[model samples]
Target: MKIGVLALQGDFDAHRKRLEELGAEVVLVKKPEQLDDIAGLVIPGGESSTFLNLLGKEGFAKLKGFVRMKPTFGTCAGAILLANEVENPKQVGLGALDITIRRNAYGRQVDSSIREGQFLHDPIEMVFIRAPKIERLGKDVEVVATEGRDPVMVRKGNTLAATFHPELSDDSRIHQYFLDLVTNGKH
Candidate 1:
């Protein structure tokens, strides 16, 4: 199956590399039109506001429609984009997942750190760099993983959002889970 990584900014290439390692065709989507052929999409971490400005209104509209019909996995800032509510309140997002996110809740870039946490069946190393924290989850959302008391991974139907950068580490289970959602037509 083909998976497109939103290549506007951030660590999109890392996600693409990991997807390829899992034996899936990867596409770097720079334009809205590039989204058409992919079965799934991955939105990488970056500055949420900058990514929104880059998307513009038209790009955001198109992405909103795309996620509604396809399986999507969003990481860090990408997760911020998918959230229904942004904590700062000034930033606009795709609002695909019914959750509220507080940007840089883990403190600033200098405060970033790595921690071992329970995400899935095994322990996963979580890298938090100016990461957002999930404030609340709607009834439809399910928590997949957590870092201490904070919810790090969440899912709602075909949409999955993680506040940490799973791709930054060597684990591909999260990506693999997303691929399964695409292949099984779970969306």
Candidate 2:
């Protein structure tokens, strides 16, 4: 299956490499039209505000529509963009996941760290880079993984999101889970 990684900014290349490692065809999508060519999409972590401007009105509109229809995974800033509500400077999102997110709740770049979290009942290393935190989960949202008492990874139907950079880690399970969503639609 073909997966498109938003290459506008952030660690998209890392996500692309991870998807490729899993034996999936990867596309580095820089334009909104590219969304039509993929089965699923990965929105990488980066400056959320910058991403908004980069996406422009048309691109953002296209993205907002795509996420609602396709199996989409958003990481960190991407998570912010997918949230129904955003704190620490609220911003509009795709509204794909019914949850609230607090941007940079883990502090700034200097406070970044590597930690461990549970995924699929297994230990997975988590890399946090100015990560956001899930403030609330709607009825349909599932907590896939957590760091301490806060959810770091969550899912709602075809939408999966993470506050941490799973692409930076060696574990591909998270990506694989997203792949499952892409292939199977839902559990």
lDDT leader: 2
lDDT (10s digit) by residue, model 1, range 76-132: 999999998999655777888989899988787889999988876578999988999
lDDT of 2 at 55: 97
Model 1 local distance difference test score: 0.90
Q: List the residue pairs that clash in candidate 1.
A: none
Runs in model 2 deviating more than 4 A are none
Q: Give the TM-score of candidate 1.
A: 0.96
Alpha-carbon TM-score of each model against the true structure: 0.96, 0.97
